[model samples]
Target: MAHYRASESKREQFRRYLEKSGVLDTLTSILVALYEEPDKPNNALDFIKLHLGAAGPDPADVEALRTEISELQQKCEALTEENNELKNKLMQCEPAPEEKPAE
Candidate 1:
């Protein structure tokens, strides 16, 4: 049997949750709040610090995490859109088959 590293497992879990998290809104808010510093590393790190409730990360690690977050954001937007489309289709669908009167 093979084993996965703790970090790898955590990343997988993060990816799964991110797929469902609708992160674009949060990211957009962060970008808007920071206004003049959208790509400024400090701005992104500050937001991460607040939500993560942790001290600052190493610069290299923060850069990597930001990249991961960006990819996750894209995934989330796609999922959100797909989810809405599916929901609309479901709302338009007919009811399921009816059971027999006695059988």
Candidate 2:
């Protein structure tokens, strides 16, 4: 009775919100494109995700970035070691500070 009416009202409101936001149109267009394709993609889900811009970065691009990061990390480690060695040398060359006597 009243509960059924309330749920129906909520459903109508949600439908109107989806229509106003253009989500319905976007999804419809993507589905139409998929339906019209001459040679269907092997992975239909991937096709949809790719069309929706959620398929993530290209594999080649990701591999190149990983290689660059590894090279940079090695270079950073070498530079840190060199800096520590220089600091040790500087400390050895500099005389130690003397403590002042209390009156």
Per-residue lDDT over 12-98 for candidate 2, one digit per residue giving the tens place of the 0 to 100 score: 999999999998898889999999999999998998899899999999999999999999999999999999999999999999998
lDDT for each residue of candidate 1 in 12-102, tens digit (9 for 90 to 100): 8887787579665666665666676546565567665665557666789999999999999999999999999999898789586788898
Report, for every candidate in turn, its global Cα lDDT versus the true structure. Answer: 0.76, 0.95
What would the TM-scores of all predictions be? Answer: 0.36, 0.61
Provide the lDDT at 47 for model 2: 88
Candidate 2: C-alpha lDDT = 0.95
Question: Which regions in candidate 1 have their CA more than 4 angstroms from the true location?
Answer: 1-56, 95-103
- Estimate the TM-score for candidate 1: 0.36
List per-candidate RMSD values in Å: 22.4, 5.5
List ranges where model 2 is wrong by over 4 Å: 72-103
Q: What's the lDDT of the predicted structure labeled candidate 1?
A: 0.76
